[model samples]
Every structure is written in structure tokens, then in C-alpha cells.
Target: MTAWQSIPLIQAEFLAGRAEPRVVTPRGDLAADEQATIALFEQARGSVVFIATTERLFNPWTRNALQVPRGTGSGFVWDNLGHVVTNDHVIAGASGATVRLADGRAFNAVLVGTSPAHDLAVLRIGVGAGRPEPLPIGTSHDLRVGQKVFAIGNPFGLDWTLTTGIVSALNRELPTDTGAVIERLIQTDAAINPGNSGGPLLDSAGRLIGVNTAIYSPSGASAGIGFAVPVDTVNRVVPRLIAQGRYIRPSLGIRTEEQLNAALSARLGIQGVFVLEVEPGSAAERAGIRPARLGREAGFQTGDVIVSLGGRPVRRVADLLAALDRHAPGDAVSVTVLRDGATVDLNVTLDAGR
Candidate 1:
């Protein structure tokens, strides 16, 4: 009967019933790098925060104003004084914002200051004795392209998530929605998404190096490319924002519109910022920098076209601003301009801008 059905029925049943759970294997200690990363997260998680924004809307039916959920992002405790730092775009149009700490404490945040051009903002809360410690700041100017970096934020509403990557690039320039360009940005592939904006980008030592700002993705998600505002800029801007309620940019006291500069550059086949009007008694005027004026014979005549500032080329309005940003007010700089097809050099001391 075909070898008696291979075996006895009782034996087959016993074999099937003998099956049991497998033994669990013990996992060894984590690697040195793994342990360090885990330790870093545990130590720094308290400094990171989740930010929820709301906008006020008036309902026609109820004839009442309502606070609707606007958006959510991430932020970090800036200091023990309850100053929370985040991206300016995170709270651009929101009527109010709430900051939630890692300890599950939520506090209503007040807008302290904002620098839209730098994409940074500061908020204040009354956390009192329960304030989380601020992150340890690190210099971004010394960061190498291949060094490991960590990002902690609430990505896609996922709270307290961590991502890690190497510094893919540095000194990158990015344009903001406010039509201003932010220079010296740090680029990484750290899985930074929408909610990651305003969160801290830390180094291996758990020191803050940058603020995760934007992602270069077409799908509205992380596509292996992300940008952060370098901590050097943050350090220079945030304290000023906290104290002054605004970041004052250094100005040359010369007015130049972007559209007009572009048109004039095209017409003249030149690549520089055309000084539209030099403010009277201003730095430009003091430096003998001329401005475009109405000409009787030529209809409209272009004056001095700024070619360079402090040895840095100024081709667009953004370039000029960025060049000026490198120096503080009262600092003297060499300005080069093209006047009547001849290059001229002038000295100008910057002034504080509004």
C-alpha cells in the first residue's frame, strides 16, 4: 500500500503536534557608533519641540471668529528664558502658535521676532522653571562635507523622529518665499520634510549646527536632498531678533528695484545693479556714487551700475544684498561701478537698515 503511507498515522500526528516556538536569540550590545547616536538622541530630545499654528477665520453663518488649524512644524528651545526658535515661514500668516515640549507640556507661544529674509523666527513662552535647556551651539563654518549630521523633528506629524545623514554640501544659496535669498546654507540628505522645518540639525557631538529649513523634492517629501540654515547665520540673527524684535540688515542707502535692474542690465548688455537713486546724505552719495536720472537728450539715462562690493561680484540685487550682509554697518567697503563704459572704484561705509 505504497510503503504503508510512509509512516504510522500516530507518528505523523505526533510529529505535527511536536512543533513549538523557536528559541529566542540574545542580541549583543550595540556598536560604539550606535550607542553614541542613541545617547545623543536621548540627551537632545528635550530641546526639540513641536509647533502647531492656527489662523483666525470669521464664519459667516455663526458671525463669530474661530481659530482654525493652520499648520504644524518643529522648533527648538533657544534658551532658558523660554525663547523658542523656528522658521519664519512656519508662522508666516498664523494668528497664533502653540509649542509642545517633549515632556507633553503645551504652551501658547507669543511671536517675539521674525526675519523673513533669513527664514527665521523667535517665539516666547512662559515655561517658568520647567523650561528645557537650549541646545549646544556649534559653528557651521568648520563643518566638512562628509561629516555625519543628525536631524530631530516632527516630520509629517510624527513626533520626535530622528534622521541621520552626512553633510552633502555647504555654502549653498537658497531663495525664500519672501523673495530674498539665504546664503551659506547647509545641504544634507537627512530625510527633512515639511514638519522638519525650524528643527535643529546637530552634529555627532549633539551640538546644533543648523536649522533644517527646506527640501528639494518634487513629491513634497524627502527625496534625499535637504537644506538647512547654517548655525552661524542663526547665531548672528537670532539673538538680535530676540533683543530687537527684528534683524536689522546693513544697507548702502541706495535704492534699486529688481525688475528695473534686470531691464536696464538687458538693455545695456551689462551684468550689475543699476543704482536708481542714491539717498541724499547717505553712504552712496557720500561715496560719490551717481544714480540714474532723466536725460533730456537720451530720454532716460542710466548712471552708476554696481559691479562689485568688497571684491565680491554683484550681478543681481540678491547678490548685492548678500555681499552687503557680509559686512556690518559702519564697516567701510570698496565698491566698483561701471560709469559711462568706464569702471570706477569708490569707498562707502554701510549704514543700518530698517
Candidate 2:
């Protein structure tokens, strides 16, 4: 059993009904943290959203009424614009859906867009009548493994369920049901069960930083391991969904060897990604992107070894790409090359990789 001693502010749902646990308080009374955590949860769960949907089932019963099925999930108010973000899986195949705010007023919802790769989606609700407090946004990039976080959602049809825990990991590229890798995810020990999908995983300040998306459990319940789509990814994708109804990312147009082996560290002489190829007419190739044609390859196709970019050391192809993310297309940058035991510097202009 993995001990959750590191995250004291929150407890897993599986552990929620268990024995009393000790916690530290400002007064040092040696009391259990459970009660105090519950109180904090109420305060942090700024707003709640109820998503109700109905589906048609294969039941040989009466007319349309018996053929209809229903389901519900949780969501939080995202902004004053009346946008709500949630897990795509939650609203998947919904014939009818609506958002019920904390104030008890309900509004119709329409799918803005969804990224199945990240298991996230944004929806637009008119809120034509009700007043809902939009959840605040926070930077997941600044979250630490042991920092406190709170999750507000409806789990297993339970409305407004709140769970707390500290971040268990960072930059976790966990795969979803479709096996698309979700990049830069925030892993937490917070108890996230069914219906919690798409709910807000907030900081102590009630700022939204992550969207509760998945849990690691063989028993279909909270397994103390949960994954959230980082808010940074949300901020980037949501606007595209709202504006153009699609997401577009210009690629760096380069390919390099993936660093699969940590032990190969000694043989590479340097710690970085190996440049393998620069696609023709790509931003990389046009900007003088070098490819690895030899060294590790066979015959006349020996490639150039790229050791650095813009004066920053690049150990792997991802490193170079990581450095490029800080820049946009048409930007000029300096690249350093390590060839035949000598270093060469070159300036190249980047092209849009769209």
C-alpha cells in the first residue's frame, strides 16, 4: 500500500470511511485532519455543475419513455463567459444534456469542443437567467508534488462531492482509454470516482488548475491514483475550440531519436536527444535543421549531430522541440552543431510547421 503521508490536506475516498488519521493544526491539538479537511472542502468548492443526459437503450418495453436512459456528471463554472469544461467521456454520446448550477437554476449546454487525446471538453451555456460564480484559474506548472489540492464533483451520481489530496506526481504522460498520450498531466492522490470526470481540481486558494479526468483502480473506485488534465493544456485548447471550433498546432517539422534508454547515457558522450532527420520543406530543414544520417546509421546517409539550440544544450529531439516551443514560426534562432569532433554554429530562421 502506498502511504499518503505526503498529502495530509486530502484523503482518498477509499480511505474516507476508514479509521481516524492524525493531522497538524495551528493550535497543535493532535486531532484528526478528517474533520478539518471536510470544512476546507466546503469553502474551496466555489461552484458546482450538474450535467444530466439521457440515452436510448435496447429495452423491449413501452414506447420512447422506456427506451430512454439517463446519466449525470459534475462540472465547475469556468469563466464569466458561461463556459464549462469537463471530461469528454462524461458527455460522450449524450442525446440530451444540461447544466444545473449551484444556485439551483438550470441551463441548456452545447458542446464547444472536445480533445479525446486529453479527455477534456469545453461547453457553452447561456446562463441566460442564473448567476454563477466562475471558478478561478491557476497555473498547474507551479504545483508541487506535495502541495494541497481539492476536487469538487458528483461521483457515482452523488452531487457536490468534495475530495482532497496533495499532488502525487507531475509531467505524467498517462494514456487514456483511446491510448493517446496526454502530455504534462498533474497526478494527485485525490479520490476521483465516476462522475468526478470533468470536475475542477483546485488549489487551496480555490483556483482551477486541473480537470479531474481519470483514476487508477482495478475495483472501479478511487485507487488513490488520479490523473488530471493540466489547466495549461486546457487554456491552450479551450480557446481554439471556442473560437475556430478546432485546435491547430504548428509542428517543428523535425524528427530525432527517442531517448528510450537511460543506460545509454554513457555511450552518447553527451546527455541530449539525437537529431535523426529534418523533413524536406519543413520549418526545421528550411531553418537549417540537421538530421542524423550516420554515426548510428548505415552508409552515406550519415546525419549531423545537433548538440545545442539558441545556446541552450539539447540532449534529445524533445529537448530541441521543447526549446522551440518557447519560440514561434518565422523566429530566428542560433543552432550549434557537433560534427567530426568539432563544434559549428549556425543561424536559422524558423518556419511555420502547420
Candidate 3:
């Protein structure tokens, strides 16, 4: 047979002898709840941004200046005038920072204000164009445990990552680098990490409920336990930061232990804060609040025990702090203290904290 005639037969024989491999592709529709979650993410993702900070390093040996990356974190748009909010530790030592939106746009950000006590900070970028939408603010007061929550941020340098979990707890407290305690924190299991700090923690309705601040991970990664500063604290602190560059929490001018314990109160025969030392010229001092004293007769006599303030029971130091925070400086509050088996009432004008 001719070569051309044999070619077709050879090709047909090879094709008929070969086995075909099956290829399968799987595609399924998303569930309704998943669709809603996707929609929520879409609605709020634009408000989130990645923050990169820079610090100037002085090289004494080279006699030259160099700018190096300080760190990276996440932040969200706060207002139309270009206010961005993030964790204070995000920009802790950064000389400057840049805010980058999801659309690949970046801007130089200047520090507006910072409150290390709450682990919150505000940054400002000039308004000209391409400003991300501000998040819809929500009140954390109404949030219940086990309610669905979402967190969007850069985790391990991965930007725009989303994690979903329910509110594990409320009214939690976390310590800040400044030795101040952040109160009324929202605890969640929504996979937060180092880069997730300062991002928004939203409810299922896409409203901002808290600011992701810390994680309870021993390995420096998300261990399914995280905490955020509740919006109630955020609302109170942010405005003050924007206006005054710092948050001034109300104070009674008395210093106590890191926390008040029931044993301490019981030993003192009082169910209130046992005054350790009242400031020399503080409102507490003016109100005749006394410090715990050492007595020869009683061995160790409790000077004064504050039982209540402004009609609110002060069972612990936190209660006293929360009560004081409700009023501003110069506001007169009625303080009741147990003094020598008798209850005494004193009016004290609140003073600014030192």
C-alpha cells in the first residue's frame, strides 16, 4: 500500500487502541446563608484598608539616613473628611505611614491622634479623590453572645482576609502597652492575627461593632480567641482623640491596686474599693478619702472604704472608674464611704487624671 493510504489506517488503529481518561469538574451553588455572608463582605470590604508604616533609621557608621518599614496592619475609613482608625500599636513607633485601599491606591497618612490606653489610633489622609467609604457604626450595647460576627483584615500580611465566628463573650478586659486596661472588650473566635490588629469587627448586618485589637494566642497566631474594643468605648474615645489628640478618662484622683479583690474588701470589713493611697491634692483627698494606714492598736486599720459613688455601688475599682467616667471633670458627685463603723457622704468635684 502507498504511504498515504497506510497513514489513515495507522492513525485509526492507534486512536482505537488508546484509553480515554475521564475529566470531571464540580460546581455547586452557594447556600443562602453563605450568599448573605458574601453580600455582607462585599458591602463592607471597601471600607477596609491596609496600613504600612515607615521609620527613619540613623546609621551612625555610614553617616547616612535610611527609611525602613516599621510594620503593617489594617485600618478602616472612619469619616468622609478622611479619618482612618486602627490600633495604636499598629503605628506605635512609625515615623510615617501609608494607607492603601482595595483598589490598589495608596496615600500618605498623618497621625491625627492616638489613645494607647484603648489601643486605638486615628490617621488622616487629605481628601481629594478615591476615599474609601466609612463603615456603618453600630452599638455594641445591644450585641448578645453567640451572635454572628465577622472580621476583615490583613492576617499574616494577607490583605482583605475574612473570618466569621460568633461573639464568644462580652464585657471582657485586655491590658494595653501603656499599663492601662481596655474595658468592655468584645471577645470572639474569629481568627485574628498580628496583621489583623485595628481592623473592624462587624455584625451580620455589616455594621461596625468593635475594633479588632488582640488575640489570645500563645504561638503568636490566631488560636480562635480574639478580642476587640467595643464600639461603645470606641465612640467615646475616638471623638475625644480627634478633638484633643488624646482621651481623658474621668478620675477620682485616688490610686488603688491593679484590681480590687473580694478578699481585700472582706478583710477590711467593706464590700467596696479599699483606698490604697489618695492623691495629695486630688478630689478624693478634698473629699476626705483616706488611705489604708498602719495602726499600733488595730495592727492595720483601713482608713476609708468607698462604698458608692453617685448612687452607684462601687464594689471594685473598676466600678468606681466606670462611675467616674460617666461624669466629666468639675462635675460634683456624691461619694459615700464607710468610716469607722459609720457611713459618711461627701461631695467631690471630679478632677482630670494626672
Off by over 4 Å in 2: 1-46, 56-67, 253-287, 290-354
lDDT by residue (tens digit), candidate 2, 8-98: 5465555676868678656645466655666656655556788887776654565444425467788877778888888888878876678
Q: Comparing candidate 2 with candidate 3, which one achieves the higher TM-score? A: 3
Q: Report how far off residue 151 is in candidate 3 (Å).
A: 0.3
CA lDDT, candidate 3, residue 226? 98
Candidate 2, position 187, lDDT:
88
TM-score of 2: 0.65
**Per-residue alpha-carbon lDDT of model 1 for 209-238, expressed as tens digits?**
999999999999999999999887788789
Query: Which is superior by TM-score, 1 or 3?
Result: 1
Range of the 10 consecutive residues with the lowest summed lDDT in candidate 2: 256-265
Please count the clashing residue pairs in each candidate, in the order shown.
Answer: 0, 11, 0
> Model 1: runs farther than 4 Å from truth?
1-12, 252-348, 352-354
Reference-based lDDT, residue 300, model 1: 86
What TM-score does candidate 3 reach? 0.73
Q: Write the per-residue lDDT of candidate 3 for residues 253-348, one digit (tens) a residue.
A: 876652344568766556888787888889888888888887788876677888899999998765676677677788999999888889999999
lDDT of each prediction vs. the true structure? 0.91, 0.73, 0.87
lDDT for model 2 = 0.73
Q: Candidate 1: TM-score?
A: 0.73
